[model samples]
Target: MGRLFMLDVPENTSIVDVARHLDDVTVGRIGPYMVIESGDSVSIDRRSTDVRHAVWYSCVAGIEGWRIAQWDKDALRTEPR
Candidate 1:
């Protein structure tokens, strides 16, 4: 499983919204964190979220069972570790 914990904040709202709508992905709350989980991988397109670079780079609060394979101007992709 690939799990990503994103900080719960206005700057990250779009990212959370996108994650909620993805197939095979689950979104839940853990305190102030928005937990995103998937059995295969966790991938989010940067353009889809419309977040600025500062917000995009700092949105993640934590992660589990995965390693970030891609995080750039294009997308944020994770692979099981």
Candidate 2:
């Protein structure tokens, strides 16, 4: 399993939406944090989120039990722990 932790800010809310659209992905919260997890991988399509470059460049707050495989203008991809 892999887990991705993001801040529950306006910039990241769209990221959560993209994550939830994926099958088997779970979204949870702890205080101001939005937690996203998946059995295999966790990824989000940047274009679909519609976040501007500034927000998209600095959206992720934290990561747990997962590793960032890719983070560019295209997407954010997390690998299994």
Best by lDDT: 1
Candidate 1, pairs of clashing residues: none
For model 1, what is the C-alpha lDDT against the true structure?
A: 0.92
Model 2 misplaced regions, further than 4 Å:
none
lDDT for 32 in candidate 1 is 90
lDDT of 2: 0.85
Best candidate, TM-score: 1
Residue range 15-50, candidate 1, lDDT tens digits: 999989999999998899999999988789999999
Q: Please report, in order, the local distance difference test score of every candidate based on alpha carbons.
A: 0.92, 0.85
What tens-digit string does per-residue lDDT give for candidate 2 at 6-81? 8888778987988888999999998889989888876788999999878887888888778899999998998866
Residue 35's lDDT in candidate 1? 94
Return the lDDT, model 1, position 79: 91
RMSD of every candidate to native, in Å, equals: 0.7, 1.1
Q: How many angstroms is residue 3 displaced in model 2 relative to the true structure, after the best TM-score fit?
A: 1.6
Worst window of 10 by summed lDDT in candidate 2: 2-11
